[model samples]
Target: MMRRAAFALLAAALLGPLPALAQDAPLRIEITEGVVRPMPVALRFEDAGGAGELLGDITAVIADDLNGTGLFEMTEPESSPATGFDRTVDYIAWKATGTEALVTGQVALEGDSVMLRFRLFDVFAGQPLGDGMQFVSPREGWRRAAHKIADQIYARITGETPYFDSRIAFIGESGPATERVKRVGVMDYDGAGVKWLTSKDDLVLSPRFSPDGQTVLYTSFASGVPQIMSLDVETVTSTALTRDPRAMSFAPRFSPDGKWIAFSRESSGNTDIWIMEVANPSFAKPITLGPAIDTAPSWSPDGRHIVFESDRSGSSQLYVMRADGSEPTRISFGDGGGSYGEPAWSPRGDRIAFTRQTKAGSSIGVMRPDGSGEQLLSEGGRDSGPSWAPNGRVLIFTRLTADDEVPQLHSVDITGRNMRPVALNDAASDPAWGPLLP
Candidate 1:
């Protein structure tokens, strides 16, 4: 009976009216072109129903998900007060800890499922920022529940699209560079729950996720030549999309609506951009002709244009052209005049990410649609193959250094801050981020 009363009081406190300061100007982080300071936040969670390890794991995952973004810094748990789930927050005490935001949650077990109740508070304003919420899922889905909670908090504070609940498809690489073996795999965005989709018998690269996240398009060298193949993510079965033995097709990318596919095909030692109806792969047609090794066709967000790399000007450069092979124009003109390749269109259609190679080394960069405001986001160390996150604010790319030639996946913010290596058991590359789950 006492527990019931405490819960009621806590709920009332969460629903209380916010202060005028909060109503007018709530706590927010406007991510601009400048550097951003990490927001100090405190997290408090209690195991209300003897959840044991499950509760602890859920809490840790939530904290890591938020901290991994390099936006939130968790306060030292020892320095925080012993505020349990049943008590109201002491805003003054929390503010004294130098924490601007606070998150309180409770975990309980009910039958075969786990229930999580959480609330976000703006400590400076001494009021709750948003409504309290509850999430119920099976024990196996605890990580997903934690990600959902992180996404909610991130969206509410940063006013950006949430990417915590998405997945990434990549190539798992092993063995020496002389005899490397690669397989296709998919994992949660944070590198958990990895599942291999293909065997190492055949080499695979560039795993592209379909818009619906139900299929993955990749390049396979199973038949002694690189060809495009589509795999059903659920069944782990693959089917060849490019069957013509006369031409080699690779670098397959799905259109926004999944109705068409854009890829690169090499026939008679000449490469060009091609598009085919996804419903009928046998009717492939060339979108660009007389190409100077044109490849890596990435569709714009609206599917009206494509960005590719070509050497028509006697040097490799980025180009933007219509989807129907018309009016190709050069866009990239970096300061030092380097070669750009592997262009990936941002999901927001505002920027195009690519790899810039020069005399020093290769670096990952992004530019506007018209090739303006080019910014290098990664340091020069053979960085290449950039793939945008679902939110378009972050990108994952492959980085290889002179000392450590082994390729590894790394993520960076669009502003070139918070660069960090992705946690993986082996060398990985060609990261393709999938859409947020339902």
Candidate 2:
């Protein structure tokens, strides 16, 4: 059972027309679950002039990215004897340290470019997992090279694609509630390289990345009424996706093919889900029409169905229906009087992440689409808005403070492990994660 919180006031302040988008074909991929943990390895830097100084930093970043997944752990270089692939091995020493896999690399100067060669080894089997590869880049491009190495190792070991090189677009907030300021901000998923995409004057919320990662769809109150707006990520130029006088739109999401935009529109006193072709904003149609409040629409992987939150059943609960707004059915049923809202269907279509309220407090949780196997992942304070990482195993959400301070973004594993705050300086919330960029 979940508890209900006093969310009417907060919901009103955040309600508006859902986000808008440009009509582009959606990017589709096979959604699958990942089960294996990241393999732990030890890296002993091979000295190469000034490049050696960056070894510590580069290895640390790789370790952080892997460990952040609640998978890999790095071995202390001091506790292990020095060994290299080209020389005698120290398998017993590594085995004693509880490391199943190991990585070793050396840097060299190749004219104007730096060359890095790294190898992965299976400690117990005493064999190389893969042939060593070399990366050549400008001396200053060591960071990018390191990330590339990490990505390669991850893909090879996990048998799945890696999202380490992708970026995130979200709302950055600051100031008091009455005088609050907000802007669109972009950063690496691991919380590095933050750049402001929009200036802070107008209030902006729910920044979602386009399929191509070249643009973002979000809600803005710059026009007094919340409207769906799209911004080119590279140029920061923006365009309003919808200009409706009779309704306020919010909670905008892009379809899998990027051909249409799905969002919630408040008409008169009723809020319903609607879709508009990206090529022609005037060609809009309502997908959900009823006496109940229908909001927070997320597309299934195939774009054939949508999962959303509705209160037509006397209390707010999760529901699923066709994209055309037919055959609606309730999927969430559990104990406690609390309700569920803000359901984001996983890109893989296996589960849906959402916010659940219980007598103790609000928390983030996930469940299968059929309304079974519901599990609360985080509890206490105020955790809401669960956005899945490119990989379905991780989720990012907002953790609110007791004083109702603006929420900060935090990430946790689906198993309710490895919870940590994302590295951002300002208050942020309503994160809509984009797919991994090519």
Candidate 3:
């Protein structure tokens, strides 16, 4: 009965208007184009129904997810008040601990399922900021449940879309640079729970996740020549999309609807972009033509257009054309006299990311679709294969160190801040950020 009363009170408090803090502004974080301070938040979870190890694992995953984003620095559990599902949070105590927000939860184990109930509070307002929520899932889905919880908190606090529940497909690299072994692999967005989808016997490149996140499009060299292959992410099975023994196909990418695939087909010493029905490769046809090489096609979020790179203009530059290969127009005009390629359209339809190469240096950069607002994300490196995260706020690409020539996956915020190597289960490149999991 006491637990029921506490929950009711908490819900009622959340529905009521919260008073602004004495400091005049509600304690909230505003993320922008600047160095992140990592807001300090406290986690206070208790195993109400003896959810032993599961509860602890979930707590750790939640913390790690938030920290990985470089947004929130968790307060030491010992320093924060130990509040639980049935107890009211002492906002004063949390404030004293330098925590602006507090999250408390209760985990109950019920047979093969775990139930979690959590609440977030604005410490200074001394009121529940959001309504309490509950999530239940089977034992195998504990990590996903934890990610869902983190996503909710992240969205509530930052007022932005959350990518915590997303996955990444990339080219896993091992062995020496001279004979690097590359395979397609999948992992959680934060680089945990890695699973291989292809073998190292094949040289893999451009591992792109399908729109539904159930399959991936990649190029492999197992047949002595590069060909685009679609791999089922769940079954670990694959089928060749362009199996012409005489032609080499690569740089495969999926349309937003997953009904069609765009790839580069090299035949008779010339390469051009082609779009084919994914279910029936017989419908394959060229979208771009002529003596120039047109490849690395990225679909706009709406799937009406494709942005790619071509060397028809005497140098590698970015271009855009309709999905059906009509009305080709060059978008990039040699940004300060450098070659640009590997263009990736932002998911938000606001920008296109590309690799800038010149005699001076190479870097990863983005620009408006019409070739304006050019911004470089990396200072200097052999950064290539730019792929946008689900939210389009960040990008993951491969960077080859100038000194070692070893390729590694790196992520950079769209604002050109926080360029860093992504933590991975293994060395990786040609990363394709997938949409958020269902």
lDDT of 3 by residue, 15-108 (tens): 6534312223446888778755988887777897869998899999899878767778988855657576778777787888878888888888
Any residue pairs clashing in model 3, and if so which?
none
Q: Which regions of candidate 3 deviate over 4 angstroms?
A: 1-36, 77-79
Using lDDT as the yardstick, the better of models 2 and 3 is: 3
List candidate 2 segments past 4 Å from native: 1-40, 47-52, 77-79, 85-93, 108-115, 136-144
Could you say which candidate leads in TM-score? 1
Task: Tell how far residue 357 is off in model 1, in angstroms.
Answer: 0.6
The lDDT leader among the candidates is 1
Write down the lDDT of every candidate, Cα atoms only.
Answer: 0.90, 0.81, 0.85
lDDT for model 2, please: 0.81
Worst 10 residues of 2 by lDDT: 16-25
| Candidate 3, backbone clash total | 0
